[model samples]
Every structure is written in structure tokens, then in C-alpha cells.
Target chain A: MTRRVVITGMGVVAPNGVGLSAFETAVRAGESGVRFIQELADRNFACQLGAVPPLEASHLQVLTTLERKTLEASGIIYGLLAAVEAWSNAGLDVPGNEEDPDWESGCIFGSGIAGAEVMRDATYLIDEGRVKRLGSGAVSQVMASGISAYLGGRFGLGNRVSSNASACATGTESLLLAAEHIRSGAATRMICGACDSGGPYAWGGFDAMRVTNRRSNEAPEAASRPLSATAAGFVPGCGAGALVCEELESAIQRGATIHAEVLGGAINSGGQRKGGSMTAANKEGIVRCIRHAVENAGIHPREIDAISGHLTATLFDPIEIEQWSVALERSGSQFPYVNSLKSMVGHCLSASGAIEIIAAILQIKGEWLHGSLNCENLHPKIAECIDPERVPQTFRKHAVRTLAKSSFGFGDVNTCAILRRYDPE
Target chain B: MAPSRPDIIDRLHRIVEPYVEDEEALTSVDEDTNLLEDLSIDSMNLVDIILDVEEEFGIEIDDEAAEQMTTVGSAVDIIASRLAAAD
Candidate 1:
């Protein structure tokens, strides 16, 4: 029999908040971390607004100066901080310098363009004929798997240490993959997360593509209005979110506090076929993934009381809402309460799914839903599909059972993770 | 003129200080103080130390010279020699 998996710990370094408590408090209050980035303005970008984690000096206290010195990549630092928080929150002991690695644990942290800052710095050094002076940690900081490597070394993880990449779907994809690893009985636990480097260089291409919001730079918080009629585009954001997924048996043995059950998740690609393109997901592929996740989870789609959509406040929001209705075979008042964390944190790219998953878990555990901020003028198309009241306008007490959190990234990659409130029975 | 031997040792000590986690191992550091074995500085960090030394003194220590810098004394020797040669 496949081992059951559950999320035992969660951590987040989000644009609006850092750490679990801060994020929970911010989400509960409907606080938006979206803000105007002066650097984007100074850089002469069309999109002058962005969201980045407001990390303080004390946030780096978890790492020594030496450790801090090596983390040149912001994404790596974000991933490491979130992973550290998740690991500690799981109540697992970190292996000491001389201690043996925990063979049963591993990490699958991912990033999208995380090495931009490091590579930019390295390019300058190389141009100056200081190639050898690039230092040792430079490559690690610039490598795609750097985030997972740092996490593995810090925790002394002996099992597989890998990084997944699937654009905006990366975080949820990683979560699904890590959960599968535990269920396959190959590992007992895994740290699954993703991060992104949100800055001029990393976001410049999207700006060139005109996919980021350009109209609401002045009122930054009003920029990312998912499921709204006035959504110009997504407000680029970055940070990390992490969850510690453990086998139920191991968790029970350790008396760990189970947060949510991983009822299993599904990931698929549209193959850029039919209406799918390099930047958009095929509706059929999304529906299939959702149906498969629900079927594999041994639950009917109607039981999914809420949806944490991959709504990035773009043209895709309506399509995603409509697809959920088609796949779940439910609509109108029967539709689940739907919300977008991106409505507050903006589109965190690879980090969005993981961060939003944490938000969903918090909402599930507390039996309340955080408002999808800045969507006051709900898009008529979305309203046509689901009841307007289903998308809450503010923090409200609403109990939800199984929640379906879906993320569709560029290149037609899609993932739907089914998470349920852990029942003591 | 070549940099003073004592000055080179001091600068070398400071450069390696950040990489060394074993504070006590750093205190008794001498010419024979092994970088990897005693100070717990790995090979990857040794390259960083070498780079910092090069940046600090503005001299390029080639790969061969960098490889010989396994101990505090050898590292200082390489730096002193490079500085003298440049002068």
C-alpha cells in the first residue's frame, strides 16, 4: 500500500510577510504586500511596481556570517530562509557539522531565473578579466539547483536533492513531486518549495512582453486585481514558500502536528497544442489534470469546497475560472469559494504556487478564507461562471473541506494539488 | 618595496577568519596551521580565500601557487613573494 502523506510544517517568506505567523496575520487581515518598487522606476521599466519580501536584519539571524556571505542570490536566500523555517517548524533536529545526514529526508526547491543577479555580477567580473576571482560560491549561487543544494547541506540531507523548474507552476509541481517521493516509500520527508528573483533583470523580459501591469504603478496595491474587470496585467513578485511533507506513519511516530493531508496532486503539460501556446495553457489539459487529481485523490470534485486559483490578474483568470467549472462539473452557488493570493502578493512566478498553497492550508486549518484583494469590480465572465459571493471581498469565517489549488504556468504546464484538512480520526 | 612579512600574515589571518567556523583553531594559527584539517575550511572556501587575497593585495596568484596554499604559512609566503615580485 502507498504510504499516506501529510504536510507537517510550513514556512513562507512572502512579499507582505515573512515567516508563518507574520504571513498568517497578514493573510487574515487581507494585507497586500504589493507596492511600488523605486528600483523598477529608476531602471526605466514600464512596470514600476513589484512585490518582494520585506526581510529585516533579524531575518538573517538564522545563518552565520559565513553562510550569509555565500548566499549572493536573493532567490537562494529566500529559499534557504523558508526551508529553515519549515524544518525548524517541523520540530526536526538539524544535523550538526559532524553529524551524519538524515538519509530519509531530501529537498526539491525550485526557482525561475534565480541566478539573474549572480550571473549579472559574474558577467561583469568576467569582462574585467577577473574570471578566477568569481569565487567558489559564485557557481553554486548561479546554478539552477543551487537552492536545493544549500538546503541539503544546511540540513545534512542524504537523500535525493533536486530542483524542479516549470515557470509559475514550479512551486506546486515541486510540492506534488516531493509528496510522491514520500508516498513511493523512497523517503520519509521532503522539503518542497520554490522561489524567484524579482527585479529588473528577471522581470525585464515580461515587461518587454507587456505582460506585467503598467497602468497601476501609482497605486501599487490596486495593480494585481485578479478576477476583476480592470486587470491590466500581473504585478511581478518574488519570494519563497516551503512545506515539509512527511509520511503519516513517520509523523505519527514522532507525534508531529499534522497540518493538512496531501490527498495527492497531478501535473501535466498542454504540449502547446490546440489553443495552448508557449504562454497559455490548453483548457482540455487543465481540465484533465484537475479531473485526474480529483479522481486520484478518491474524492469527487464537488467535495472541493474552495479553490486557490493560479489567477495572476491577467486575461487568463476568466479562462481558469471557467475551466474549474467545467472540470469540477460545478458552477454558480455550488462553485467553491475561490480566491487568489496573487491579488495581494502579485505574481511571484515560480514562488506563487507554493506561497498560495501555504495560504490555502492556513485558510483550511482556520476554517476561514482570506479575501482576494483588489478585485472589487469582479470580472463579469467570472461572475457568470461562479456566484459573486463565492469570491469573498474580505476576511470572513467560512469553513472549507477539501481545497483544490491549481497553478498553470507558461509553456502550458499545469498542476492541481488536492489538500484536505487533517482529521484526527 | 615588498610588503612587510608581519603585515602579510595579519591580512591573511583576517581573510581566512570569516571562513573558519572553529574559532579556537584560528587563534593558534601559525605558518603550519593546516587550513582544511584544523580550521575546517573546505577546498571550495580555500579558493575564495585565495581570491580575497588577490583582491586585497592586487596580485594574481596562479593556480600552482594557489594549490600550495594549504596552510597559513604557505598562503602568506605566496602573497609575500607575489607582492615582492610585483614591486
Candidate 2:
């Protein structure tokens, strides 16, 4: 029999705040963490800046030593810090600090651009006519797998380390892999999630894609408007999110508080760019992933009470969600309360899936779903996507039996995870 | 380090043959065979192939080279250039 998997602990280094308490408070208040970037002078992009976590020098100081130089936009370091907090929360002995060689734990993390900031800075130096400015450790510093490896070594996890680079879907994919590890008896416990810190490369890339909100330069906080009819495009954001997944029996034996049950997850590739566009989100592929996850979870669509949507404030996302809704309708399932976190946090790319799962878990725990922060007008098509009046309202009375979150990324990678609410009653 | 074109092709086939499903379809594939069309390798798998080649050759293919590796011939040429540069 496959052991049931549950999230024991969660840690977030998001724009709203760090740690569980701060995140809970922000989510409950429906706070917007989107902010403007004053450093970039070019007005070519509508949004000058994005909502980024306020980094303390002390935070990076811990990850760096005299012997090892740290990478810029040290997202891996941030992820490690969050992992430590999650470990502490789970009441597990720090891995490397313990002498036990047989500790059964692994790490699977996701990142869109692991050390993009490092590359950006190095490239800038090379562009500035300084041939010697390139650091020799550039590859190691920017490797996407470095974060997972660092976590594994730091926590004394023996050998089992995986890193995913599915752009926005990376976090959710990590969770899926972690759940697989537990089900397949590969690891008894796992740290599964994702993180990313956008540097100039990300900014430039998104800018070139012309998918970023450029008009919200004046209203940085109100820029990311998911489901809103006026939304121009998405805003670039950065953050880290992680969770500790343990076998249900192991968790129960440890007397750990079960947050939610990882029911199932599915991943699929959308064949060749549709409509002659690479960035065009594939509706069929998106629906297949959701359906597969729902089927794997052994739950009908009617059972899902809420959906933490991957609705970045882009033109195509709402349409994708609409297609998803049409599929749900065809499946004879109820349309759950659907909303997007990108409206509040901007799009964290690699950290997106993990963060969305975190939000779903919190909604299950607190029995409240945060509302769209700046959605003055719901997209007419998605206006019926969910109840528009439900915006900015909290739902405590409804028993959330199941929740689903979907994440999509470049290369048409689609991943969806379904979670079952943990009821104390 | 200077692997012949045939050697490079053989090695690439070894790396990608497992991933390629239509064995009969790919059996007649030549140097000009487009990886995307002939082998039907997806972009994500293409990334895996590049990483595999990097580890095997101990040479990094820059983004430009990686992007240009659309066909067997291009991949071989890119590998050759990187190997020569490294030497």
C-alpha cells in the first residue's frame, strides 16, 4: 500500500513577509506585495520594478564564508534559510548537525533561473569592457541544481537531490516528485518546493517577451491585476517557498501536525507551440494535467472546493483558466472558487507552484480564501469563471474538502497538484 | 578531444536513441535529420541531451550553440567547435 503523504511544515520568504505567521497575516488581510523598481531608468517596460523581498545583509552573510564566495541574487541561499525554518518547524534534528549517517531524507527543489542575478552581474562586467571580471566559479554559482545540492549537504541528506527547471511550474513539479519519492519508498521524508530571485536577466527576458505590465509604473502595489479586465500583463516578482513532506504514518508516529494531504499531481507537455506562438498557453495540455491530477487524487471535480489558480496577470492566462473551467464543466464537476496569488505577490516563476500550494494549504487550515487585491473589474469572460462578488471576501463556513493548484511554464510544461483538506472535526 | 563527425554522430545517437521512440523511423536518419522533426525530441529533453553531452565532453555549449543544435549536423558542428576551443 502507498503511504499517504502530508505537509508537516512550510516556510516562505515571500514579498509579503517571511515565515508562517507573517504569511498568514498577509494572506488574511489580502495584502498586495507588488512594488515598483526605481533603479531601472528605461521606460521601455511598463512596470519599472516588481515586489521583491527586503533582503538583510545578515541573511546572505550566513550562507557565505571566507572559503566560499556567494552568488548574487542568492536564491538558493534564501531557499536554504527557508528550509532550515521548515526543519525547525517540523521539529526534526538538523540533518548535517546530527551524526546519524542513515537519516532518511531528500530534497527536490525548483527554480526558474537559479542564480540569474549572478549571471546578470557577470555579463554586465564583461559588457563594461572588463575582461577579467568574470568569476571562475560562475557555473557553480548559477547552477539551478546547486540549491537542492546545498540543502542536501547542509541537512545531511545522502545523495538524493533533484532540481527542476520548469519555469513557473517548477515548484509544483518538485512537490509531485517528492510525493513520488514517498509513495515509491525512496525517501521517508522530503523537503519539496521551489524558489527564485529575478535579476536583470529575468527582467530583460520578460521585457523582451513583452508580457510584463508596463502601465503600472505609478501604482506598483496595484499592478498585478489577475482576473481583472484591465490587466495588461504580468509583473515580474521573486521569492522562495518550501515544505516538508513526510509519509502519513511516519508523521503520525512522530506526532506531527498534518497540514494537508498531497492527493496527486500530474505533469504533461503541450506539443509544439500552438497558434504559431511559443508563449501561447496550451489549453488542451493544461486541461489534461488538471484532469490527470484529479483522476489520480481519486476525487471528482465537484469535491474541489477552491482552486488556487496559476493566473498570472497576462492576457492568455484568463483564457487558459476559462478553458480549464470548460473542462471541469464537461467533467460534471462544480466550479470551485478560483483566484490567483499573482495578483498579490506578482509572479515568482519557479517559486510559483510551491507558493500556490502553500496558499492552498493555508486556506485549508484557516478556512479562508484571500481575495483579489486590485481587481476592480473581473474579466468579463472569467467574470463567470467564479463569483465576482466573492472578491475580497473570506470563506470560513464552507468546508474545503479538496483544493487544486495548477502551474504552467515555458516549453509548455504543465503541472497540477491536488490537495485534500485535513479536518480536525 | 577532436572527435570525428561520425564519432560525434555515433555518440549522439547513443545518447538520444533511448529517448527516440520510432526506431524504424529514425534508423535511416542522417546528418541532416532535424532533431525536432526526425527524432521528435521535445525542448525539455533537448536540454537533458545538452546536459548529457556537456558532462560527457567536459565542454560547455553556450546558449547560442545550444539553440543552434536543431539538426544532427549542427549538433556535431557545435560539439566540434566547443571541443576545439577547449583544446
Candidate 3:
């Protein structure tokens, strides 16, 4: 029989901080992780930067004896922190818990780019001095799969070690793929998420595309206004949000504190229609994923209390999400209270989906939605996208039945994962 | 001058023709026939044809030649030119 996967525990190293408690405080307070690009000024680029929490490299000492030789940071640190938190949350020990060994625990986290600092340092080594003096570990450090392999080795998680690179959707895809593995009986548990270290290349790439928010230069906090009509664009941020998903029965037998249920998930390519258009998002693809996820979860559309959207604070992308909302409405159910995390946390690119799902899990756990900060006036087209009144001071006690997490990537990749409330009793 | 290498034409046709859905209509297609407008191959399929041609001809196309080889005729010309340049 197929196993029903559920998130037993979650840990995050998001732009705001390194733990779920810190992340929650930042989200509720509507903190902005974006800051002025100090390094990019040397490159002559005009884009704001987002950095993950200052490396308390001391935190990693418990996991590894490797000294902090270089500040070549990426999402790798966030991945490690999240994996460790997840391992503990699942009541598993390093090198695997007695009940479910590390060999049965898979690691499937990803990042669009890895070890960006390594590249930055490597270029400096070659351009400023000698090529032969370049760091030998540079290539291995920056490999896109480095985070996955590193976590796998660090924790001895040997079941399935791999990384998915579907641009911004990578993190969410990693989670969905993990859930699929559990459903297929391929593994008993999995650790999945996406992270970025936050730097100039992230800012410069979006700057070249003219998408990073440059406004509120004086007030960096207000720069990431998602859903607000005055919203400029996205502010780049970095971090990792991960969960420990296991077969529902196994989690209950072990008395794990189940956070939420991975009800169902669906992924699809945005075909030519989406592929041909650059700024245009394929509403059909988003609708299809949502529809399939809802159907697979065996939940009626009305039961979906909220949707955590990709909402990247882009001009055209928000409109695409609104279109998705309309499509959902046409199916005879009211549009779920939709909110974008970007408004509060800034757009984290590859980390967006994972972090957004983190919000959904929290919403399900707390039974309340955080209001979209910096959205003074909502977009008139989807003004009902999110109800501001639902924002709460603390985790709500009521059971939020179902929530959908949606993400869209550059190559027209639309992915949705349905998270449901699981009662462990 | 007309090309006399029947083997080259056969190999190229074998690589390109199989990918085209409508084989019977274009069974007698010559090297000069357009791949896009004439054969109705979309841009995406044209890219696949480019990859297939490169593998069959054992020629590495530079970025400029890749752009120049938009149509089948242009692609054939670019491949023949690359071969001549290499020799």
C-alpha cells in the first residue's frame, strides 16, 4: 500500500532568521530582509541585495568540525540547518534515528545557483592575481547539487540524494518529488527545500531583467510591496525552508508532532503557450495544477481555506495569479484567501516556493493568515485576493482544513502542492 | 556546382526526414527545400533538426553559423561550408 506523507517537523534559515520561531516573528512583524547592494556598487549595477542571516558559523560546529575557512556562503548553510532541525524534529538522530535509519532518510534539496561566493572568489583569484592560485574546491563548492550532496554526506542520508533545478520552482518541486517518493514506497522519509545565499549575481541578474525593486531606497523595509498597486518589483532575498515528510502511519507510531499533511501535489510544463511568452504566465497551467491537486486530495474546492501564492511582486506576474484566482472562482467556489509571502520576505527566487509552503504550513498550524504587508491598497482586479482581517497576533487554534501552495518558474513550470491539516491523535 | 555525394544526402535525409511527421508528402524533398515555411516544422522542431544534423555531419557549429542555418537549405549550405573550411 502507498504511504500517506505528512510534514512532521520543519526548520528554516530564511532571510529573517535561521529557525521557525525567528521566521514566524519576522513574518508576523512584516520584516524586510532586503538591503542596499554594497558589493554590486563595485560592479556598477543598480539593484538591491538580500542576504541570509549572518553566518553564526559556530552553529555548524555541532554538525561538522570543518572550520569556517571561507565565507563562500550559499543556500548550503540554510540547507544544513534545515536538515538538522528536520532530523531532530522527526525524533531521528544524526546518521539516522534508531527507528528509521539515515539510509532510509533521503535528502532532496535544491538551489538555482550554488556556492555563489565560490564563483565570486574564483573570479577574483583569476582576474586579480594568478589562475593557478584559484581555490581547488571552487568547482565542487559551486556545483548546483553541492547542497544536496553536502547534506547527504553530512547527515549520512543515503536513500535518495539529488537536486532539482527548475529555476524558481526548484524548492517546491523538491518537496513534491519527495512526497511522490513516499507515495511510491521508494523511501520512508525525506528532507526537501531550496535556498540561496543572497548576493550581487542574484541582484544583477534581476537588475538586467529590470525586475528588482529599487524604490524605497531610503526605506528598505517598504521596498517589497507585493499586491500593492504601488509595488515596483521584487526585492531579492535568500534562505532555506525545509520539512521532514514521512509516511503518516510511521509518524503516528513514532509519536511525531505532525505539522501538516502532504495531501497531494502536481507538476507540469507550461508548453509552447507559456514557453513563447516571457513575461506572460500561463493561467491554464496554474489552474490545471490546482485542479488536479484539489481532486487528488479528495477535497472539494470549498474546503480550501487559503492559497499561498508565488506572488513575486512583478507587474505581470501578480496579474497572472489573479487570472488563476478567476479560473478557480469559475469552478463554482469562492476564491480562497490568497496571500504572497514576497510582500513580507521579498522574493527569494528558488527559495520562494519552499518558503511560501512554509507559510502555508504555518497557516494550517496556526489557522490564520498573515496579512500582505506593504500592500497599502490592494490590486483592484483581485482586491479580494487576500483578506487583511485574517492576520492574527498568534498561531490560531482552529484547524485550517486545506491550503494550496503554488509556484511558477521561468520555463513555464507551474507546480502546486496541497497541504492539509493532519490530526495525530 | 551540384553536390555529387549521394551518401551525404542519404545520411542527412535519414536524420531529418524521420523527425518530420509527414514523410510521404516530403519523400522526394531536395536539399534546397525550406525546413520551416516549406516543411512546416516549427521553431522548436527546427532546433532538434539542428542537433541531429550536427551529430550526423560530425561538425561543430559556432554561434554565428547556428543562427545562419535557420532553414534546411541554409543549414545544408552552412554544413557544407563548415566542411570546406575544416578541410
TM-score of each: 0.97, 0.77, 0.76
Give TM-scores of chain A for all candidates.
Answer: 0.99, 0.91, 0.90
Alpha-carbon runs more than 4 Å astray in model 1: B1-3
Off by over 4 Å in 3: A49-51, A96-101, A126-132, A274-279, A330-333, A384-399, B1-87
Tell me the lDDT of model 1 at A244: 97
Interface RMSD per candidate: 1.0, 14.0, 20.1
Query: In terms of docking quality, how is candidate 3 classified?
Result: incorrect
Looking at model 3, residue A295 earns an lDDT score of 79
Give lDDT tens digits, candidate 3, residues A12-97: 87776667887777776666666666676567655545545645756666444221333255667777787777677768766533
Error of 1 at A70 (Å): 2.2
Candidate 2 docking: what grade? Answer: incorrect
Residues A1-425, candidate 2: write the lDDT tens digits: 76788899888877777777787788777777777676544545545868676667665544534113334555776687678777778878764443764357988887877677787777888799853435344565588687887778667886378887887889999999999888888788999888887655666778777788878788887788887888888888888888999888889889998889999979887774564135666678887888899898888877777888888888875687676776567322245777788887889888978877888898887777777666777777766565565444443434566888888888788888989876443
> Considering lDDT, which of the candidate structures 2 and 3 is the better prediction for this target?
2
DockQ of each: 0.80, 0.01, 0.01
Model 3 CA lDDT for position A73: 57
Better of 1 and 3 by DockQ: 1
Tell me the tens digit of each residue's lDDT in model 1 across A29-138. Answer: 98889888888899889999999999998999998779777777888888889989999899999889888999999999899877678888899999999787688888
Q: Model 1: what is its DockQ?
A: 0.80
Chain B TM-score, model 2, reads 0.92
